[model samples]
Target: MAHLPHGRKLNFAAGPSALPLDVLQKAQSEMLNFNGTGISVMEMSHRSADFTEILTQAINNLQDLLDIPSNYKVLFVQGGGTGQFAAVAMNLMRLKPNHSADYFVTGTWSQKAAKEAEKYGKVNYVLPHTKQFKGVPHVNHWNLDNDASYIYYCANETVHGVEFQEPPSHNPDIPIVADMSSNILSKELDISKYGVIYFGAQKNVGPAGVTVVIIREDLLGRAMPSTPAVLDYKILAANNSLYNTPPCYGIYMCGLVFEWLKTHGGIETTAEKSNLKSSALYDIIDNSNEFYHCAVDKEHRSRMNVTFRIGGSNGNENLEKKFLEEAQNLHMIQLKGHRSVGGIRASLYNAVPVEHALKLADFMKDFQRRFGEPEA
Candidate 1:
């Protein structure tokens, strides 16, 4: 196997996370002429038999990895996760027009989802953040509208580094929709618990431009009057996501990723690996002894992304800058925090090898010994 160029750093970006090395090489080999067709996948017509086989393989691979039930339909569409926020509201708000929908606001993304839904129908924000957006509030404290149409939440709040360790139990009759953008396919999930699950492909799945939607079959064709034909689940599902020429290349890449995951022992093994990487990083943070602090609550911390800040009397700006500079010098790129929060973040996605996390942890310990005050 060809190796990466010397001195190339490990990437820790939250979105557009690192892809498997083999997948990239496979794409490179197929870029000029796929299967002797003398054409790139990007140039193939959506209706061509080659592209049709590619789409079918993509869907089949996804279904196999997730073990999706026959009752669910997977649609690969053009919009990103943000577009699904509006699409979900449009298709699923078909209950009696005046009824409200419940939203569990764990962080910024859920809040945005609620705001979009409000334009389509009544929206009730539930489980508000009271303790600095640290974790999901206790379910009993939620003020759910008994007559609401559905309940929505973002399973992994990538920006705040919060994740729901357990699924929420809301009105049983109402469907539960989720945005699993950053954490999808990293672990196993009970698909039956959700009426709809949507994710952007830029994170763990594949590349940008494709959004995967897995919806229960019963929920199709109930779109609101104002819903566009393209956004309607019924139309997309019926046409097998080929309505208006889907993002073919993105879907093909996703298939390659799914195959890679299967060869690596599927979601269970992936979750085990992810747990080890996260534990290694978090152990460093927790043991730093006032030198580093993680903002998210321990129970709700995300395994996919770890956010932390250095300790000091003043803000830790100087230490953060030093860490970034040192990390760059050490060939570690994109370890900076998200703009919404001004602290360091390490996103340990499935594609990031365990050795990468170990190296990062070692760097953190060395940096602390050099810069942090000695314990008295």
Candidate 2:
């Protein structure tokens, strides 16, 4: 807590998560005058040379971090990941007339994407879920349509704390679309594997009001007749993501965050640190015996969102409430699980340091010793 600047709590919210303190401090310093422009970033015109340079550098920095190929165009758009759900189907579905694109539904977000896509064109359910949305099922069990326009899946399901280590294999002709809203930049990835990767800026990037979309060149220019001009990727790409007013402030803050990542050795080192942080937290839950259980299968567990619940004989709502209260008292906030899936969730985002995660793990171990295995 003492190390945290501005007395900020250890935030673990799902989206709109934490941003690096250095980035915030820089933003604060530039709040009144950004780069001698004598105007706040929020007040600047998106067409101004200063803002354009910022946008250009941001894209280049991101491309460097993710090793994005020259063919991929990075656009900062509005409407977040949810907007892309419709945009993707409307644009990519034009590749084949009326072909049903496959969707691998793993959690709440994925299911929503599938439903939205149905409005644009036919949709294929690839690995359907029954009871709970936990770990991802095997690809062998998936019923994929090779002739479909493209295959869609959420790279990280924030609600259920499920994640796919990489994009799924599909017909070579069909592109793979991924919603990486929650886990983007938390680690290294094969950007080339996905034809389109979209994520809301609020999570690991910067703030809300902006969605970053990376689309391969080959996948552009195929939008359906009904696709809106604002939602069309090719149009946005042609304009270098400055098609309209745009989320100017969000893009500015995101540029700062991207610069911050590049200074820290990019995603390669970040992934190493993330692995350690997630491992420390997972170890506590695994060693708790009957005291706790993570619903997600081990292999597909998310390095960003760790979901679990108390499971001992003493486990109940009252104890869980007590746990949340105690966590807050200790300056750890937003540790409660999502309302949809009641339990506990600790979102280990890129900005969350490893020491904080270790502190939470220590607290969990202490809690188990006090209330769970008191007899021992």
Candidate 3:
């Protein structure tokens, strides 16, 4: 097994995933005295001018990277994607008199979001729930509610390795809400297509603890009567995400990540790299002569999380175990799949280089050569 530079291993964890080395190094250097303030960002006050600058720059960089519209407000709030599941319901359920919303359940994450939304209003499943979420149901088959407050769906399902090929088609009058937690910066998106776009920073953004909400100007001030001040988009946007002291260090780290992406040729370049990396890995899985299998549909496969199995669909437990062990031995760590659906998941986020992906593909080929048998 070849060693990576600085003795670091390739990490493919789904969330809290790999960050740019340059960002980490920069953070390390600034750990003691950030911007000559004589205190670390973690130790600084949220209201301080220095921290304010960090927050502002992060918002600006992200806006530029995603081409966020001038009408949208970029807010940094506490709580991960799970919190937004409820928040989405709490805030948007009041948009219409019926107090209902349409949810397109694709996989684990979206299903969970829909379940949470049920607590606050009438939840309509646009597509019937299936035992196995292998692909997105056709838009034409969706049972959309014309009077629903908003349309909700996860941009990518991390655990199931399923992703939407594009935004779902819906009524022009109704707004769309997307939870882009796993694939936020991995590709370019049309910000104007949705009324609300929120994501946790842990995946392709920055780190955990900070969630970024990009909400259209019109969507504000619609929170339910029970909505907390902290969770209210109107309040957060009004305060510029400074409501009740935000996640200081997490926001700072996200700012650094945005800067790193900008210097590395922006979102378009990252999108191309993401496609190439996922395609190489998928090619290996597809051409593995039944030695490997990806259950996801060809069109809806996730670029960030590539989930597959060893020894075919049923999956040989022993071979799968051995593959993970050997891959770890080769300094490739966090290759294990999610607990709910056990197999192997290689999360090739923006930070994961194409070369590393190719290396993983090569390793997969060699593993099959050693362990696989010719089909009868």
Candidate 4:
């Protein structure tokens, strides 16, 4: 309901996505003088009490939102999601020597994670895409190594628009590690199912620079000796994610975003809203039949990133281009698809209202009316 300064159009970029309006205003109002400290959050020292209080509240809010049990420790660290690829590998590889790790390759991000883990230990890759990245591979066919260290998976693939509606069930002894970079905090998930869950705040949380890691306490202190102190989870968790200089400003903004989530009725409410938005958009895609085709399988379509193409059989070269141009002219920005996949992608994050999705559906219908085959 609130409007941006000078009435700017809504934003729908994948990461560094739109934030709650009130949260932005609160941050702006406090930018010059935080809590009467007469200094910006950016200027405060990480060791100061003011900043410490901010960090504590932020972690508590995160724990509360995720319903993380006492067995799990919430960590706020730097290096974004990509950094965690190496961090998870370095820490978990401390398992007994000769143990291999299993990874389910759903999309580009998961593939990158598996590749990173191979540098440390034997990595068993499952469900690879030799042709083009599509839906998640059937988990029933996944070959599991009983002696593996752990299993890693990316719950949602932002680039390829693939998502796993349900978590994979694996051997109880083999821990599960997840990269929820694009869809963290957007839905309700059982925190106890995984040994480690890491996500970048830039998407669905707040801004770039900070990554949130929820790891079971038992998984700590297992880092390889060569692992750097800062990257080591044991050291960072011991110091409360301040082993060295932390991303103070980014963490503070994330705290504000957490507060916003609380006010919006927590993760369950947000998940319901997300489902509505995704369903509205996907319905339009489904009803279009041959007019618009989704590359990913129906069962594994992503709720956050709805990807579709205009031309199905005709293979019209400029159809996607026209869609982007017209959508932009109508003030629907950032609807262009990723360079890797040539089609339009609508990223509906937490901050995006259902009305935006409706507007998008309407536009897609009108666009189809113009370019699609005549209705029977």
Candidate 5:
């Protein structure tokens, strides 16, 4: 609830989102003399002992935070989540080289993941494709492929604001790969249920350069012959995420964030705060008498990203524009929705405080009162 540094604005961008102010200050303090190495983390050699300590400490903190099982290996790689889309297919498809992977597309990211996988091997849709992604279908209705190499899904869809509250029920023999790009560390998870979980750090973790991949040991070493060494999970794991330079600075920043999360009572406390934050915004939208609308189903609404409109279901462009302008005037930025969805999106990443969400909620209520049609 402490005020942000002077001139700092509340940020709600979908990715490349907010980093905790504490993390930023710590980074700034170490910028010139990281551990007295006399070089910035950006300048340190990945092979140097100082940098090795940073990397190892980072991995340990992340493992502790997630309680990552001993059977899984965490790799920090490049290319964001989009890169992993291909890596997931190339690595896992070869698990059952003759079979396909089942994709349950609930939103834009999952849809893109499925499409990218097709370049490597057959991708079967578990649910019939729909024009709009508003909510997840019942598991019973899903057309799952029991023989699939893996079952893929996105934990949270940034664009549609739909999220899977829990991993889908699937055959134990088939692995489950999840793109948790936008929602990792927001809550406690049963890590054992997943085969591979990958996330681009820019969302809730840290900066844009590093992508974290946590894959079960058995799933590694399965990349197709044509797979690039960089994108190959087995190669990255074997090298300890240093097969190449890796994202040293970004990974360092992620380490700080992880420590911040741990010091702030870890994932359990973070999840409680996240639920309160999203609920504050959703309550405003729900009580707005149709002045505001959220297309996603109530149960599937994302705790990380809340997407809605200023007007009715279709939205009122002028009023929405005015809302953004006013919010900017008040130092709240990046509330615009994705261009494809065309509305408003308020990303409540872990670094974002619940106080900010309440501030936005107050703004929404005031905006509605001033511009909304009077109820008779």
Candidate 6:
């Protein structure tokens, strides 16, 4: 096994998940004196020249990685995805006097986003008749109001382990906004397709403090009078996300991650790595002969977080507990699913190495051999 700090265990927990070992090491090396400034990034002033350069380079690196349009302003704000849930509505509701927002509720996060938006304006579910968040259906089947302020959806549903296989069909005039908290930087994206893309840094980007918001030029200056300046896209963009003291340390660490990504061949290569890692576990599930079950519809399975239950009849909780306990004993920790829903969820973010996935897959195969009901 590759040596790790704290003799690190393979982390599979979703959000605040795994970061690249190299990134962590680099952070360690620089924690004491960031670029010869002799102060930890945490101690640096947000308004200082060194930090300004760091912020600028971070933005530049992100623009190059995501192909953010020149007309779009990338702002690093203080809140997480939940914060953007409100900010998206507050900023976009002013698009018209009769403003309304439509949300595609494919999973828990998007559902929460849609609910939070109701506080700012009228919110409608694009697929209210849907029974479950297993997968997305035909986008054309959605009852979309073309003149709506913004059509919102989560690019990846972290909880349900579903992802948009393709961008949803939408009216060209009405902008599409995405909460890409889990899937951002996982793969190449068409930046032009969305008027806005925002993600909390904890998942794939960096740590949890900073939220990156990419807003199209035209979407700015539309914040309602009651909108808090910190939450207003235009105001934050105008002040360069400096309306108040931003997450200095978070931004610095995230910048290091961006640099790591670039050095590791950008998002395309990183995504390839992610895809391979997920398949290592998924292939085991697929071949497990009713011993394992993936609740997500196959077509919509996420490349980041792989969720599954175990056993034949109704999955044996005893077996599940045994699996978790044994896996932890192997130093592969945090394999438990979210409390809201119970099952196993292995988040294979950009930083999780393929070797770790293989080790977990091997462990899973052994568990099934020992505990799985014998084949007929």
Clashing pairs in 1: none
RMSD of each: 2.0, 1.5, 0.9, 1.8, 1.3, 1.4
lDDT of 2 by residue, 237-263 (tens): 999988889999999899999999999
Whichever of 3 and 6 has more TM-score, that candidate is: 3
- In model 5, the runs with Cα more than 4 Å from the true position are 1-4
lDDT of model number 5 = 0.92
- Candidate 5, residue 58: Cα displacement in angstroms equals 0.6
Off by over 4 Å in 2: 1-3, 312-315
- Per-candidate local distance difference test: 0.87, 0.88, 0.92, 0.86, 0.92, 0.88
lDDT of 5 at 23: 92
Positional deviation of residue 67's Cα in model 6 after best superposition, in angstroms: 1.6
List model 5 lDDT by residue over 74-183, tens digit each: 99999999999999998899788565999999988899999999998889999977989999888777998877899999999999899999999889999999999999
Q: How accurate is candidate 4 locally (lDDT)?
A: 0.86
* Model 1, TM vs. native: 0.96
Candidate 5 is scored at a TM of: 0.98
Candidate 1's C-alpha runs over 4 A off are: 1-7, 129-131, 312-315
Please write out the lDDT profile of model 3 over residues 1-376, one tens digit for every residue. Answer: 6787778898888889999889999999999999999999999999999998999999999999999989999999988999999988988999999999999898998899998899999999999769898889777788999999999999999998999979998898999999999999888899999999999999998888999999999989999998989899999999999978899999999999999999999999999999999999999999998789999999999999999989999688899999999999988889998999999999999999888898899999899989999657
Residue 127 of model 4 has an lDDT of 65
**Which stretches in model 6 have alpha-carbon errors above 4 Å?**
1-6
For model 4, the stretches where C-alpha displacement exceeds 4 angstroms are 1-5, 313-315
Error of 1 at 106 (Å): 1.1
Question: TM-scores across all candidates?
Answer: 0.96, 0.97, 0.98, 0.96, 0.98, 0.97
Model 6 Cα lDDT, one tens digit per residue, 119-209? 9888878885654678887766687877688899999988879998777888888899999998889898999988999999999989888
Candidate 4 C-alpha error for residue 72, in Å: 1.1
